[model samples]
Target chain A: AQSVTQPDIHITVSEGASLELRCNYSYGATPYLFWYVQSPGQGLQLLLKYFSGDTLVQGIKGFEAEFKRSQSSFNLRKPSVHWSDAAEYFCALPSGAGSYQLTFGKGTKLSVIP
Target chain B: EAGVTQFPSHSVIEKGQTVTLRCDPISGHDNLYWYRRVMGKEIKFLLHFVKESKQDESGMPNNRFLAERTGGTYSTLKVQPAELEDSGVYFCASSPLPSGLAGVLSSYEQYFGPGTRLTVT
Candidate 1:
């Protein structure tokens, strides 16, 4: 089974500071990796996804993630984050065939401090 | 175009009661999926439907959970005799084409719904 792991459970960053959320995955074959964000009591919104080519994939809201096959990781980054960026970030693996589900991480809660 | 739509944004029911959650996928999408997130846990796969057919339902927790997509346009997930463990957010997703095993084996994206939160008290 494919799985995604987000090492950071909680992260606090000063407003306008850089942000990086680490993600690791375990899969027999190369997996489809993604980053999603969810506000409190809200539905998830896709931040970005890495399919093929371009080791670094850019996503909505100034979010970007780099896929490193050597390390089996896809870490999300933002040059400078805003207060609006504060939310729960999830790293996910795509489940195969049946349902084509996106296996999510426990999620990293991002807190932006002013 | 409208995004995925899910009904009853929040539902609170007593344990052992019944609850049904509905999802309307984006128009023209052929693939629809159901996933659940138990509190503090990873979002787990529930089932997948391809034009009213169950492609894979391997992740369904147990017999208590039932999901149906009668017309292949909309879907419903019913939890009967709900248990405390069933409390969590249920998400629906759809894609123009079924993101087959090859897609996962290769790469593709799945659009998501807002999610229906369920509380079994």
Candidate 2:
């Protein structure tokens, strides 16, 4: 079965500092990759996705992710972090037929310190 | 267009009681999905519905959890004799397949709703 691995469980970054959330996946072929953010008491919102072409994909809220097939990674990056960016980040991969069901990672909790 | 919407944003019920959660997917979406995050565990898939049919229900934990989409419009997941471990957030998602573009495997983004949090005490 396909799975997602988020190495960082908790990360505290100073405000305005760069942020990178690592995500590694285990799959036979390069399945659909996605990044989602869940704010406290909020739903999971899509940050970005990589389907095909363009190794680097840009998403909402000034977030971007690079799909590196060689590394089997799709690490999310932001040049500068904001207080609003403090939330739980999840890396997910398509699991079911035609890639419908999503297999999510354990998730990484981000804390922005001022 | 409205995103996915779930009823009873939060529900607290005693153990061995029954709880039914409803989900209304985005308008015109043919694919609806149910997922849950149990306590400290990662989100797990519960089931998938294509129209009124169950395409994949392999992830359903047990028979106590029943999900139905009678009209293929709204869906309900009922838990009979809820257990303590059933406490978590239940999420509903939906995706649409535009007309004249049938059988195409494009667009896999599933819009989520503000999950329904359940607490079995």
Candidate 3:
């Protein structure tokens, strides 16, 4: 079965610190990957995505993710954490080829400290 | 352009009652999707719609749930005799029809709604 995994349930960081959220997928072949963020009372927003070329993909809100095929990982990262960055992050992949349904990870909640 | 929108951001209902959730996708999008995330669980796909037709409903949990996209415009999902375990945040998403170009990633991107939080007491 294909699955998306975000090992950390929660992560905390001080403002201005670097941030990294891990994501790994198990699949027979490379699948389209994405990262999304859900702020409190807000809809899930697409942060970044990886397909075919350019392993490193940049997204909105100063976030970027690199797709590593050998590791089967597409981890999200930010150079500096903002208090506003505190939100739940999810990793996802399309259900199958030519399909629009997404299979998402459990998500990791990020808490920022002053 | 406006994103996907779901009605009744939050709803609290009795276990045996029926509730209908509506989703209005972006004006020109031909693909709409439904997903749910129960407490402490990953978000899961419930179904997909291509215009007015049901493209795939393999993920629907049971027969008690019925979905429709009349006129290929907006969609409605109704759960009859809702169960306690049915409580979750339901999300609606929309995307443009894929152009059939294998490597074009933009065509597959989905815009999501805020999600309706359903609480069955």
Candidate 4:
């Protein structure tokens, strides 16, 4: 089975400070990883994804993620955190089969402090 | 280009009632999907439709849940005798074409809908 785990349930960062949210996944084979964001009462937005090629992938809103196969991790990072960046972030790995459905993490709630 | 759209942004239904959710995928897109997230849980897959036919429905919880894609343009998911556990946000996504190993090996982005939030009391 494939599963995603975000170790941190909640993270609070000061505005403009660098941010890093850790994500670890367990899968039978190489996985198609993705990072998505959801604001309060909003749908999940695609932030970034890592299918193949580059271990380091950049996404919208000044976000990026790096896939480390050896470590089984794909951590999301932002150089500078903004107040607007305060939202729940999810790490997902879609099954590599007929269905394109994603198995998501419990999500890590990010809180930006002024 | 219009993105995937879902109706009934929020619905409040008593337990044991029936509820229906609708989704209109982007035009020219032939792949449609349904997923949901329960309270404080990860979003789980419900089903997939390639056109008017279902591609896979392995994730559907039980027989009480029904999904349909008519004319391959819009899709509907109905839950009869809704249970409290069914309360969550339902999301729909679409792709320009049927995803195969070629597309999967190339790109892995799937556009998502705004989602419908259902509350069962």
State residue A35's C-alpha deviation in candidate 2, in Å.
0.4
lDDT of 1 by residue, B1-121 (tens): 9999999999999999999999999898878889898988888889888889998898899999999999889999999999999999999988767366654432246678989999999
The digit string of per-residue lDDT tens for model 2 on B1-121 reads 8889999999999999999999999988889999999988899999999989998999899998999999999899999989999999999998876455543444478889989999999
- lDDT tens string, model 1, A1-114? 777889899999999999999999987776778898998766788888877789999999999999999999999999998999999999997765333568888899999999
Q: What are the runs in model 3 whose C-alpha is more than 4 Å off? A: B100-104
Report fnat for all candidates as fractions from 0 to 1. 0.71, 0.79, 0.82, 0.71
Error of 3 at A48 (Å): 0.7
Which residue runs of candidate 2 sit more than 4 Å off their true CA positions? B98-107
The total number of steric clashes, by the backbone 3 Å criterion, in model 4 comes to: 0
Predictions in order: lDDT? 0.87, 0.92, 0.92, 0.89
Assess candidate 2 and give its lDDT: 0.92
- CAPRI grade, predicted model 3: high
- Worst 10 contiguous positions by lDDT, candidate 3 chain B: B98-107
Query: Residue-wise lDDT of candidate 3 within B10-110, one digit each (tens)?
Result: 99999999999999999988888899999999999999999999999998999989999999889999999899999999999988875666524655788
DockQ of each: 0.62, 0.78, 0.84, 0.70
Model 2's DockQ score:
0.78
lDDT of 2 at B91: 98
Span of ten consecutive residues with least summed lDDT in model 4 chain B:
B98-107
